[model samples]
Target chain A: MPWGKQETKPRLSPETIDYALAKAVADGDIVNLRQLFAPASPLRAWSPENIYSPKYAYLLPPSEQEGERLFQEALALVRDPDIAEHARAQLEKDGPPQLHAALVMTLADNAVRLGKFGAAAQAYEWLRVRPRMQEEFLRQGDTALDQNDIARAVAAYHAGTGLAYNYAAFPEPLPAVPDYQTRALILHADYPSTPENCVAMQDPAAFIRTALSYVFLDAETAARLDARPLEQRIAFTAAFVRRRDPDWDAFAERYRNTCTFVTAFGRRLAQDTPPAEAEDGGLAEEIEEQQATADPREIEARLLGRSIPEGEWWQYLKELAYEHPAAALFVARQSVGHGVEIVMPRLREDCPLVEPLGLDVTRTSRP
Target chain B: MNDAGYVDYFAALELTAEAKQGEVRKNYRKMMKDLLLSIGRERLTEEKRDRLLLDMARLNAAFYILRDNERRARYVEDRRRVIALEEEWRGLAETGGAGAEEARRQFDRAMRDFLTTYMEDLVLEAGRDRECVEASNWDRAHERHAGRVLRHDRHRHYQKILERLPFHEVTAPRVNWEERARVVDAILTEATR
Candidate 1:
């Protein structure tokens, strides 16, 4: 229990294993994934056009001179903490600069995952200093509420409302998303919530610290998202949804590298199963339950198809974020590498037209 | 920075203009003599003399404006018509830019809080290098820090909600609105102490 870089422990469940792999990439544990998948052919096609690229490794420089040059640039960046600070300062002095904010946050977040705590703190600290629309919101809230513009009012109300539930209720670690209510208004920075808009971040810790990230009225959204994840996903379905130009068939039929699997350890999970075809892993159990209970076809018809009207999927996500902040946090918090796999592959069965456009229905069987 | 002395140089001269030109010249001379006499004592250093010369120039400019009754009367009327109108542009610029800079400052403050909390347990490795006893106690501490981070992060996010507003720094602790009024006196006593 003395914590000085003890050997990594055996993963608890297949789900945990998937969580680890996803986390490896998210945490920038690129070499760890390579070690995990060392036996597999590295150059294999994750898709027809692309190789199964890993996040950790890069092409070795042709000359040591080139390597040294790259090293020096990184060294310069690291040797001075104020580089980021000054960059952020310039961004504030300038326009609504998105690139610096996103890049700094990502870089610092990635750095933390790579075990650079102090640097990460500085980066996060920098983002805290920018202008947000909360004051205009307080002034605007009265008019918005009076005007009967629910979206506008909701946006304003969140800026001024002093609800205390945000950090008082839930304590952390039991659930990935903690539950809490705000002592002040919940933020809505990216106001005019278009489909493309990034949701103004809420303090997940307010929920997590208070244990508010868990406990859902609907148990389905209660499914905890592993912050440290294993696996990769780029759903054709999501691409379809995200598309400004609504092209359905083009998305489903497309197949890309949106799948991940475990290496040698993954096959061991199947050992517990009677046969390769038998669905006995913990994942199978949940899928079986979901299939038996919540029909995918119905969910697709009601949620995704053209019938239920505009922002249907978007609304579902909002409701999920509202009723189950943790679940929303789970999705919100998802790193580029980790998340759930298709037990039933509802996107394929429901949106068959989309499948032909190249749906990467890669069943991430534990390697 | 020292724009204050230039005030009403011409107008003041006009206000007392009805006196004869000879008397006016005498009054101006007397005023200059007094002004010079007031600052006459010096270290006799060249740098000190130059500093006095700037002051002398400003007085001369004021007298030049005031010596003519017509111009002085116009200046006097102008002063009455407006309050501190000379430095209005600088004041406005400072107000606008400072407001903008302040919002940016607050946003950065909130961002740090978010990063600290979101990456808390992960970066800190809650169980590692942490001094404690008992698994349950460790768990509780982790949870406490973890939750605190989140709460702080939420505060950061709310800051973003208010990001565009002129930042009114609430240095006072969160107390009832009634208690807020007493804050100034409390602060004043502490400042003196």
Candidate 2:
């Protein structure tokens, strides 16, 4: 009535809650932020500014407001080591369907990045039954492989195959770590039982580094190690360095030098190779070609022939005894059975070969 | 003269006798799946249900016998005997000597008796192994499971005998012999194994 002045006031709307939440997040008010996004809170109903209306529904579906909040919370939790337990606890608990799914996905991604593959696999297992998470299962498998959880990786890949409609159409096949290779990695003295160690064994530079540390430390020997392929280098190192050193003292000295050389050589090689090629392209094609052409049977025969001169035939026989006891026994029988005169000189006597063959050497040696 | 004594596990499983272990397992899975689907539909007449049930029993028995290498070896041995006896019975029947019919009847009874005993023993052995597994003793369970797998690789020492035996010829009415075999199969299937 007085008409002294016209006064205007800022109006509060549904989005004001989101604006307030964002402010609290930016201010690092974790408690207030969590409360605003809690399932029972009225603020959880507030949608993002870019939500699709009925008129523009074709553009994109509306983002679930609760999922957005949960995703933000997960991001914050991942950064804070102290409150990370709460993040994991929240993930384990039930919440809004969309938020629960989003939280799990976030946790899975974070776990994979942090190399906590077991936790990542658990999260992916929960997501596996849900729609639109086939790729997540594949990621879980890859993460499992990084941890050398072969059985779990295989299971994840199988589950992913079941869920994915066009999985066959994908350009690249899933990576497979064969059983024998897994066994070799586990049993090999020089090779630490880690997937990263197995992967590093594939790199020529990495092979050189490992060889220099374990076998020969000279730059000339390291260069020679680099010239040959990684598999050959690994085989050579395993045969010459690891197996030949009878005593641990000699092995310890060799191992110490190899370690020192590996640190220096790895840095040098990293600088030599371009980041792009190192990351994606180099040596993969060459390695694939070598593997495609290599015959395992031929390699085994060659290795067997080579073992005779090195006086390592007994060691080879010992290794074979566990896997092919019948074959070993047959060889032992041939050496000492009806025609002992024919085969005795040919048989290696360094180790009691008959013992590993599961035969009594003294009894078998008699005609 | 009936094919009752000459039941080939391969023929029962709708596979070649020379089928590998993988093929045997695959056929078994497929046959089981189809039978289960039909049985689940609940649309069969009583007679049809009985026939299907008997077929299912035969299928199960055939798989068990053929899947284990040791059992398969024994089955192969018995099959050889049946072939030989059939051959001898055929020659006698064709010659038409005095008491030829009685001689043939003896041979037939001998063959039938052998088959019955062999099947009984198999079911009993499998039952004993199943009991070991059921006992929940991990060591015995592991040993039993491992023994079953190892039996898969048993050398076929009786291969020469298998090759020497002539292919069995069916002489009885198809439906009658099939019904008789089904009855035998049902008995074996219901055995504790």
Candidate 3:
């Protein structure tokens, strides 16, 4: 034979399809049932939803009338009370590999068509694809949420997403008159802030960063917060604040004012610093002299009416602000929109003026 | 109690304080049903949805206190204390007499107790945002930067929960304790005792 050998394929005729289904039902032959609904068989037309369509359009090669007749006949047989009872009894017993998988799939497809998604999902368990199960559940959740059925939505979301904790697990339809405990539980869940999960913040770094930038913490505590590894930030902050027992509003505001001073003074110092690089030769010496005169101690001495040799100004101011918030607040308040000259004159006599009078300076200074 | 720092639950539910238990229950159910129906019927924006949720939560809180006999009695008693204290403080400054200083000291203690209650309540309300982030598993929702933005939005939405609170008015300038104390002092001192 010059040509390739030809093999005859076994095709299922209508009579064979009918006889196979009847025998399977009567004998409880699930393997026969599997074969009938297998993708290679004509009976695969039964589930239109599972068909990929257009790309796998060839799967529906059977004419429309033929497909419909086969489906209607099979459905009628399965819907029969004696047959269904027998199939249920058979499913409970030990059976072939992938036993009744096709039977369950048919039931699922029918459930889907009837818009009974919950029942459909139950049937789909026989197919056993986890991702598909999750998708079905999430979809159900979204539907329930839209319908304003929060109880159903919460349950579906929990099942679909595998939430580690349930936020609101109150009784369904909500009791018309709940007991004290139930009301408390509902309030705890619905209220925006609960102490239930204080041990962990969603993003401690982001929160702490905001606090630091906003100057919601003192320089020392801010430094402490900065040094702590990412995970330990929230607990440390919560504990630190708890011990101080300071009113948070007052704390936040005091730092915010100090920040205003530090920022403005920092900018003034930046503008006064020698901008030209030291490598620029002759100007470098001039800049060095400028830095000398710019020194913080010299500025303080000059402010106190005592002349002193100039020194490095910018670095001193920054370190002073970082070390002593009182000095920063003092300079910030006195030197608003003015040069360093305007504020330093009273350091000797009015230095007592900056002694934090009624202000709680301990909050800003290092503990 | 149309004042900024107080909530009148009876007024919130559109009922007088003297409304019977049956009336309170009937109104709550009707309002809740309407709220839920509106949610279902409307295609709500994120902002609108948040507003609705907050309204629902506030409604729940109010109903919780009013529905119970013991809670309702306690709430009514607490409200009376606030009113009487405010009246006494106001009366001090208007009718300053021989014992004014002692009256002022008494008023200060009462004010601190009121402040403590409100501050704790505000903290509880603010803690909601953290709980929400945990529940939604929002940290893993997107890449780092995008996720942070979403979290910020979430926090801002939760902040509105605090804004709705009456205590925020009293603690408005949260930072300046000196000024706050002065103002509080002024309220009590300048009043006609």
Which candidate has the highest DockQ of all? 1
Residues A1-367, candidate 2, lDDT per residue (tens digit)? 3577633323433344434433333333323434444554333333232222243232221345334653356445444543333433442344521223333444444443333344444444344422234354545545554655544444444333333221111122121111221232222323222222332323444533543332321233245335544544443343333222334233233223323332332232212232223433233233344556532222222322222333332444444323322122122101111111010011223222223222223332211
DockQ of each: 0.02, 0.00, 0.01
Of the true interface contacts, each candidate retains a share of: 0.02, 0.00, 0.00
lDDT of 3 by residue, A1-367 (tens): 3578643334434444344454333333334455544544333333232333344333332434344533555556765665555444443333221224444544444333333344444444334332354455445545544555444443443333321111122211110121222322221222112222211122445544533322222223244336445434443333223222334334333433433333333444323222222133332244345555433333443322233344233333343333332222223212212132222211122222222222233345321
Best by lDDT: 3
Instruction: Provide the RMSD of all predictions against the true structure, rounded to 1 decimal.
Output: 29.5, 29.7, 30.1
lDDT of 3 at B78: 72
Alpha-carbon error at A347 in model 2, in Å? 98
**Candidate order, lDDT descending:** 3, 2, 1
lDDT by residue for model 1 (A1-367), tens: 5877554323233332233333333443334433333323122112121122244233222234233432334334423444344433432333332223333433433443343333433443344421122223334544543454434433332322211122222332111222222210132212222222222122322322222112222122112222211110112112212221235333232212112211211332222222223443444344445456532222322222222333233343444334323222222111101121211112223322233234434522222
Model 2: DockQ against the native? Answer: 0.00
Ranking by DockQ: 1, 3, 2
Classify candidate 2 by CAPRI docking class. incorrect
How many Å off is the CA of A346 in candidate 1?
A: 18
